[model samples]
Target: MYKSPLALMVSLSTLAQYAAAAGFIDDSQLTLSLRNNHFTTDNRESRGKIGNAAYTGQNKEWGQAFVLSYASGYTLGVVGFGIDALGQLGVRLDGGGKAGKAGVSRTPGQLFPLESDNSAVDDYAKLGLTGKARFAKSELRVGTLQPKLPVLLSNDGRLLPQTYEGYQLTSKDIKNLTLVGGLIEHAVGRSSTNDTGLAVNGGTRQSNKFTYAGGDWAVTPALTAQYYYGKLEDYYVQHFVGLTHVLPIANDQSLKTDLRYFRTSADGANDTAAGRAEGYAGAGYASTTGKIDSRVWSAAFTYTLGSHTLMVGQQQLSGGSGFYQVAQNSLPNEGAGPGSYYLLTDRQVSSFIRAGERTRFAQYSYDFAGLGVPGLSASMIYLKGDEIRTANGPDQHEWERDIALDYVVQGGPLKGVTFSVRQASLRSGAVSDLDQTRLLVNYKLRLL
Candidate 1:
């Protein structure tokens, strides 16, 4: 049932009068975060294709970003109402794409929006508003959202974070259970202020409705199970299942096992060749026929002892396609916008997911707290993927290595300040061969 706009306004006005005086204003929060980020990439083998500038083979960008967030506590009473707001601004310091060779020009959308001449904009800003209602342990939110579910992993890898326009309902009334469902209509890119429709890998055509429902069940204190289903109108349908378990050994040691599986198939337009001819399919390398048919699975094991943690994992892709998520360069006129995959093998420079691929990965991490350095950490990871399917050639393989270091101020005036560095190298037979590095400094201040 749909209510008229006037009716909604009237109902909202009534609820405003009953706003829980104490809870609504007392628990509200406002914060502002400052981020300074620098990113550099070397195109390795794919370099020098555009030979106009001296630095044709490399891409570098430095930017500063500010994010302001506000959340109001729900009003008291049988039903509560609230509002949330987000504001973000990003300024480019250096490195927007300049003029390249005659016919081959580089696009300028790495960390900022592009101008009419394909140059990066000096700055860009975005604003979001959300209205929320609550009853018991369930809440409903409408408008801007950043959902971090298996089907929708909001991207925050760039100078800014991505946002989606949608309505979400989450309920936790049952014991040890969380139920989630939502409908998303549009999304704002990580570095874009424009809101655009949704699509998959290499698709140019957009879809307006993406719906999902899921639930997480905690069977035992150490075991949890998850199931989710998602459908992108006229694109594809996906089903996911996950299980996680933890085995406690001692006070300082434990083992964790994580397993995930997904099944995806073509829907509406993607089910027909004619529709795919009109740009209804995903990346061609992911599916030779441009149709969605995939089965993906992964298993990871982690061991924690003292300040040292080790993790090992493996992932496999079956059927005719590789694993894919929403909003992968799907916008018609946008460069590579931010999109994230919630896979164990999703690492810096490479996701390690391709058609008929098998990947094995490992990581070692150390916490400096044990060494009396309270808020410092370091980690290294390596991944190797093999047997990637090709259209008309033999199978290929690829590998990637990444190192990361982070430090955070534990106390004092600069308490919420952090510094991080990440470097990654990839040698891939499927994707681009590149080396990437990122440096970031972040500080957060409470405004209310």
Candidate 2:
């Protein structure tokens, strides 16, 4: 069954009021983090359509973010109580032009809000709190959550991390087994001040209830398995299974394999055309409204030797619809669109998730520690996708290349400071040819 957002919030508030006993202030930890981001994208498409050309030029933005967080230890008792709080602020430094800013009423702008004239806003800020309680081997948290599970990963690919308001429970009563479940009612985008309901990709209708459950089991020392199930009211239901294993070959060499599978189907109002007409269906197909039905699987293998690693993977999508993931980008009058899915092919620019698509990818990475630079690393990757579903074409195809470099201060006053850069080039028949770049600097401080 589904629970209303109001009911959940009220229940949490009531429990927190009663749990506010002693030790609340004695065992708390606070931290602050700062991040600077610069983003640039160049679209090389020259199509004649106005809508296509809107995103066909240079788009750039620079911003900074400050995150303050506090977590309290449990109170002294059989069943302990605690609370967590988070505050975030984002300020834009450049890229205020209204020509190419992504300020979609439903989708998000790059790093700021869209004004009435479609220009970027100066700044945005938000605050969140969570009340928590713990038993012997189980814990419950209600309110703002950044879930990192495979089925519904929280998006942190921007100035601020995406958050959700909900109720979540976790248990580790059985050895090597971890259980998790949650009821999510609302989502806070990576660059928004308000919360919105949830929906599938390309969907305009919103659903308030998102229920999920999952578990992870460590079957052996080098092998672990995962399974999860998620459902959005009136939209669709999905199931995921994953496996990971590592085998040591030599003193410093090993091979790792990761496998993931997902099955999704329409539910409730999205099951038929009449239901879809009422605003409950996935978009991005020939007809613009299609039922959710897909089966996707991906497997990747990595071999590491000393400071070098090489990886290769392939992902296949089969069905009439693409992969199903929650995306609130089309909500009315909302200027934030943040969504993420757990796929090997999900990259900086595009996610190779179109229907009837098959993607092949390869990557090479090197650690500079062997060369006396302990905190520096570099990697490059290439991916090609084919067999895309299209209405006007026989078949569509695309390819992408990505390069990344990162360095962190190993010691000194800036011990935790890090710098990173990423560049991507993509060419496709379905969309456009594009180039994107990102530069980031981050630092964290511990404040008791």
Candidate 3:
């Protein structure tokens, strides 16, 4: 059952698609997509306050999103150019009652700054435009972007989704090598759909710019290396290095290995008194003068045989406080929750990289395409985090298990659409919370 006008709009969109296709509608580059998400969670840890709390009841939520896009290709010429526009809208279909509470602030809303008045907001919308140029193996884009990088990943867990306004340069000038560099000055939160300032967690509200540079190099047909650097104004500086190798074992069999490392420290205004005076805060063992340093390392390996793949990984963190980054002013990204960092030391459901923590993880995946179903797959992952030591002592441990199923329409009018469902269970003896479930559906259309 649907509760908001936006839900009705999504349904109507699907119907309109079928109707247009049936009526042989032509000459217009129009595309309609709908995504429905249902989330249910049980928080057994806290109900009242921060420290003192009881078990909270189960919560249920339902949300729907609609995206309508239009684009026209450039006319024939030596230099070709085109314009593209995107329209996004979201609505709360159910939940918002006592059973449904706010879990993540990434969801879109119009009436309320963060949460709606006792209930989820009825609807929200945003418009995006892009100017692009291409030549040979290199291309440049200026305007809004949703980049999935180590430092500035676009969070799409909620409705409208967060977007960055910036300029990016990408090139594949060399074989099997990709280079990227960008400067971003502003961000639009998931809810508001308006470009605003930036800030880090526990820091004073200020406009902080983000800049990053990175490259991936292929040494061989089976080996690759990656390196990147990122900085958030008055926050922390991060450097990342990674290597991946694929080893051939036999006919149609291979072993894949991944090695990653990160080094982080204080930077810019965070290193000065004026910046600290402006309300900047540091993570992990901040001294009287407020300085911190951190290191993280991780390695993972996967073995593939027929339709099954098995993976195992280990990660460790040491030195100053946990990893740090640009804090969220209004909402947090999917993996950037409290006590979490953008490092190899970040374990699912728990950050293994505290003052001193180690984590181990294993995962298994199956492709039904090998069984004749082309677009169905399943995966399960488990992670255990322990050996966390601080001024208090080493007496904390946590673990999480996740299962996921995914499928996409391979043929027919709904071809190219995708659907996914995920479930997660987490337990901890350390300072954390309880279990949660997330269901997501995604549909993409190419209008060019």
Candidate 4:
């Protein structure tokens, strides 16, 4: 709300007279980033759910984005105060159609907002602000928030990033442990300029309130454990637990293991069959009408040697329901809702979290620096999921493979600039077979 120069200056003036004026001014940061993205996708199958070509076929789009970020240092005092700001602008470059064209009424692609005649907007902009206060080892932030906890994962897969409107409190008051809690009211999708209420996939209704609490404990220098709980008002209640451990196999070799589990069930409106028929429901195969009831678990292990890293994982979903996460698809012409879930299987294409699905995945990445080529890297990921539950069908299966290459300017004027190329292919019996590719160029500037 403090958009005017006068309001911002007033807020800044209050910091000087506080306990530590130097801390407030000395620790401030301002940065600018330019990101160029080109996306292309090919759908090997589809006649459109609405029985039209508008929602099927190939999709290609390009865009340029400018992101400005600023973080102010807290005033040195018993209760420190600070502020954060994010400003973004997106310019359409080319293309109109989106990759996935589902639902009844299909709009234009997901890259940019559509005009009155279903044309892409030339440009769009957005702003975010956060006010914060710190006491001892705890900090409370109110306003725009981006949470990266187990319960909530902010998505940044598109030209811009997904953000939330709410307040969050984080504390390190306890030794060897970090505590976090937040209350979010709304979410902005990756390709959306407007903030919408929260809901599950296929949910026709929306809920504005989402609450979460969690903590991470460092059991030892090589081991950590985590637990988190989240609830969407009148939708579902979810719980998560995780463990991570690392062991040194040699001076230059190490192995790491990660385990995660989630339990979710219906609540409030979704608690009754009548409420589900009224529109409060989840996506995929649901044993109890439209209710949310599922349990998911995954375990992964990684081995690192010099510049080579290999990781393998498996995940399973049970209870006649798909994985539960905050997704807002109740509206028409929306992208894949909020963002990516915190799962090893969350990749460039399918997420592999279908109902009763069992997924096994693997990845291998290498750093070119080991071969005397600094700032270069490559990675390959593959995932296969089977035993997908369906209401009318016997069963289903799907698989995806992704390959990526990246390089960064090591020196000269273009130093710190990055170039990346990513390609993905998916084969499935659920939606459609597809191939996707993305190219990105990025540069960052430090203004302060």
Candidate 5:
């Protein structure tokens, strides 16, 4: 029998609430959001007969999201209980072959998913519910969960964010420290209602069970540290440590520093020859010869003064191969897909920070608010990644420059609305690609 756990939880919670002597529905909130985006990309190769000038194309996407959330407070009991529900809907508009079937909404269709004939479906929807219990500063939630830890982050980059069907335990009993642990078995992709297994980018087609535990500690008012351990069944084990601090500088100025380190190695089933024979090749780089281990470190510092902030960072990779993660089913960005927001030390360009690779980056930003314009901002960032070591050739290098502008309406009819434009130029001596650009506009509306 195919039964939906989310549906069952919501039903059971509602029934239980009716049985209670007195129940209070704490809050019921609804939100409606619409986002329209026009994306264009042009790829130009510097060498090779692979085509000198890649064609230029554009895609227009329209997304509508509706969320209805309900939370109930405890009913005068020692153990507090509650229920939460979320419903989502997405639709495609103005995106087809003529406008450049550059996205999932056209071409093979399946804008969201394919029908029996393998054509794109124009609309999709999903419902999720979570039952929770809280006591003191600890809470346990089962069913739909959106975890935001470094090891297990929910991707919310698309029309509808991905969600996990799992259970999570969070505790903040200790002052200045927060603890989180979870077991996730499945994930629903941004464009799909079906829950699929987990995979890393450029990895084999298989899903591994994910288990993780971590904690963050605020060592001081201006300093914080974090450590986490993550495991994917039949694969590698990952450990991460991070530290952040704010150093006071001149008058009304400060320098913020962030440092992160990750060490990944094979374990359990991945270490056994029989396990290797069964396709448990670990993470990072996997070849017919053997698997590779990886260690990466990054440090960044930002100086804030007046309306401007300047940032510089460097990253180094040492190991048999590059950093590794679970296989991914879609594009790569800041947290998940392409065009990710590099947080100072993110060496995403060329995946430099590959084995034996070193990368350096610098960024500058100015907020017009201090100069009387509250909603306007501009930023420019440049990153140079080099020393990429691979068996194919000698060390290679690549560089990219990005410029962005943003504005948000502070008041009036469109208050809280935001607009953003981003442009990038990339050059690589090792790779043939030259440049790319992305523009995005987003807005949100709250209905309660």
Candidate 6:
């Protein structure tokens, strides 16, 4: 069933009225957050060789966002019910007339709305509503959602976070275990003000159904395991398994290991040749077009001592096909936007998830608190990927190096203010070469 905005508003209004009259105000909460963002990218894809929009060249933009949210407590009853509302406004600080062209912000109207000629509009705003019902240790939510799971993770690389329209159920009735199931229909991109149907990468056909089920189990005090299954109707089906363990070596030293695996296969339209011709195919590097068959696995290890941490990891992808993930850009109605994957290689500049690819990564992170400088920290990362399978041939490779710094006000008039900076350099034989930087400031306030 489809509903107009007015109909949805009326329904929300009725729910709010009922909840208020039932004396649920005692547990309600409201908050407002402000964020300022400055992003720039310089892509060196060689003149006339820029096949992907992400490598279009020097693109830069500045924007600010305000997020206002309210959550109402459940009503007094055997089965409690509640409501949540979220509203956001984004405004452009500086951008116009082809100053840059890299991420969504470079598209003029992406961060803000667009004018008649595709120039950036001054500002744009969107509102969302969610209703919740709970019984015992189980809760059901229907409406806007931001989910962080092995199957699907929301993107927040830009000024605002991506959101999905769906119905989800979460239960923690069993000790040390969590169960989650959901059905997603539509998604609002991190940059766009509109909603688009879901589809796999490179699939122009849109499907409103995305089903998923998953669970997380804490096997022991230092070990955890996870399993999940997800399917995008007519696109692909995927299964994931994950394990994490930590071993304490000494009072101040420990080793943590993280492992992940994924298996994917074509489904419905994507499983047939004719269906692929009709735009139901997978994206990224692959030997065959539109065929979704792949296995990917990765393992990471970290050693921590005092304020210093060191990590290394590697990922491998089978040559049958590239990894698959739901993205709105692949939908026929959206702007062919870029989406992210769940992998260690999904970094600031690129994702090393190509067919037959193998990636190795390392990182060093330090906390300033050990040096008497609280609320400050920094990290550096380097990743290399090789043995990619492409239509032309194989043996392609890419690498990226990144540095990040973050600081927060510990105590003062602006106690909770934060500032962060990130810089990255990427070199790729198959994709494109580029340098990028991002600066962000954030503050939050209690409203009620």
Each candidate's clash count: 1, 1, 3, 0, 15, 2
Q: Which structure is stronger by TM-score: 3 or 5? A: 5
Q: lDDT by residue for model 4 over 387-414, one digit each (tens)?
A: 9888785788889999999999999989
Estimated TM-score for each candidate: 0.91, 0.91, 0.80, 0.90, 0.82, 0.91
Q: Could you tell me which residue pairs clash in candidate 2? A: 106-329
Instruction: Please write out the lDDT profile of model 5 over residues 239-322, one tens digit for every residue.
Output: 889999999987869999999888877666565777665555533233322353678888989999989999998988877766
Winner on TM-score between 5 and 6 is 6
1 or 5, which is superior by TM-score? 1
TM-score computed on alpha carbons, candidate 6 = 0.91
| Candidate 2 least-lDDT 10 residues | 1-10
In order, candidate lDDTs are 0.83, 0.83, 0.66, 0.83, 0.64, 0.82
**Number of residue pairs clashing in candidate 5, backbone atoms closer than 3 angstroms, sequence gap of 3 or more or interchain:** 15
Better of 1 and 6 by lDDT: 1
- Give lDDT for model 1: 0.83
Cα displacement (angstroms), candidate 6, residue 329, comes to 1.8
Better of 4 and 5 by TM-score: 4
The RMSD (Cα, Å) of candidate 2 is 5.4
User: In model 4, which residue pairs have backbone atoms overlapping below 3 Å?
Assistant: none
For residue 260, give model 2's deviation from the true position in Å: 0.5
Off by over 4 Å in 2: 1-22, 25-27, 46-55, 98-108, 286-288
Candidate 2 C-alpha error for residue 254, in Å: 0.7
Q: What is every candidate's alpha-carbon RMSD to the true fold?
A: 5.8, 5.4, 6.2, 4.5, 5.1, 3.8
Q: After superposition, how far is residue 213 of candidate 3 from its true place, in Å?
A: 1.2
* Consecutive 10-residue window with the lowest summed lDDT within model 5: 333-342
Which segments of model 1 are wrong by more than 4 Å?
A: 1-23, 46-56, 98-109, 286-288, 336-338
